[model samples]
Target: MLKKNTQHEKVSHRKPVVLMSMGAQERKGHDYQVMTVKYIKPLAEHAGCVPLLAPTCCGSEDIEQYLSMVDGVYLTGAGSNIDPALYGQENLTPDKQQDPNRDNFDIPLIHAALKMGLPIFAICRGMQELNVALGGDLHQKLYAEPNMLDHREDGDESVDEQYADAHQVRLVSNSWLSKLLEAEEIPVNSLHGQSIKTLGAGVQVLAHAEDGAIEAIHLPEVEQFTLGVQWHPEWKAAQNPNSIKIFAAFGDACRLQVQARS
Candidate 1:
């Protein structure tokens, strides 16, 4: 359990603590990027949760304690790719980099979250982790599909330009995402190279790309808030109403979790 707010009396009220799965960068001195300051802004201001950076490459038994300390879990975009063997396939991207540490962290957290009925929000590679963790498969290279669209943006463009709306994703009618965005379709910025080829058990396709690739998914059987998006909503959560809704709903779930735990 979280320590009661021992700070200012005016701010003694405890906020829901949400764990963020940090990505490791060996090139950057093998440091973990768990302190995603930019990404945590909307989560704190809009989601109303205290975002905590979690240590990756830990034991499965440690996951229980970590989950016990937090109200929710958030998996973010990573620089490394999950091993193809995770889904019963060989490494298709032999030339690319892989992060077994990230996979080890994501897979266990996702499964434990499901068993604990904890709220979860995954983005980009995080979504792929959720799929694979739940017995789904990946397309490996979405660009290879003649009928599918490339989800990445221009590399030459500036950061803001690259993160601009890449395409429209149509939401499934009556899906949780459709209700959150209050629209049949939503414009999202894309930067993922791979996409989900098959959905996992208890997972529902919530949104799709123009070429019909899986762009978003959710745990239909889960009563807690669980959502995964192909795009990076954290890029503009405070500015985008669509992004705001996602975090806000997640925040509400975390608050409820805290309350239940208390």
Candidate 2:
């Protein structure tokens, strides 16, 4: 059983806690909520921080308790679209896979983390949520947009296998993302249908696709490191130099957050 820890433990002795989102599980037989711990752990450890598996299915008691204990948050990629209700639209197409439970969990968490100015690294769906939570919008379907290539390849969505690099994103000059990557443009694997349409308040566009789709975002006003990218850096970080640099930068940010608390 996952018990909620009530107190905020000592900071100096604490590990740098990263709150990652988890998915709903299927029951094998007995009562157990099975969820796979995805991207953040191995990559985080490589960057020198401990990763905590923070599930979105937890009750309010668990959510509040865990958020209070963590040092930082990592909003990971999701397979479903952000509920259209979140952006004041009705569900145009039904996606049964959507998890309202997880959506509800993350919305408030994003706001709370922003309020506290915690360092946040959002990838793919996480990036989209950050924008929506800040009053921005998303392109419901990328391929529908004129001149936009298929953002996601047909028939295969998983990132574990070898795939062709579909497109390149041009980083804005002198932008935080460009500086971090030290490059003008980079090849990225696109596996998302929804993307940033209008950037949120205080959020700056850091990178864009050749088709003008928003690829990366940052909040310059926020003191802490807050960035969102459209690609899955965790999967590509193993071999791609640019992806590796991006993760290394995030890890560095996590380290700094850990140091400040200590």
Q: Stretches of candidate 2 above 4 Å error?
A: 1-15, 25-38, 156-163
Judge candidate 1 at residue 240 and give its lDDT.
Answer: 89
Which tens-of-lDDT digit does each residue in 116-221 have in candidate 2? 7678888888898899889888888777888987787566555454344778899999877788778889888877888888888888888899999999998999
Candidate 1 Cα errors over 4 Å, as ranges = 1-13, 28-35
TM-score of 1: 0.91
TM of each candidate vs. truth: 0.91, 0.86
Best by lDDT: 1
Task: For model 1, give the RMSD to the true fold.
Answer: 3.6
Give each model's clash number: 0, 0
Q: What's the lDDT for all of these models?
A: 0.84, 0.75
Model 2 lDDT, full chain set: 0.75
Please report the candidate that would top TM-score against the real structure.
1
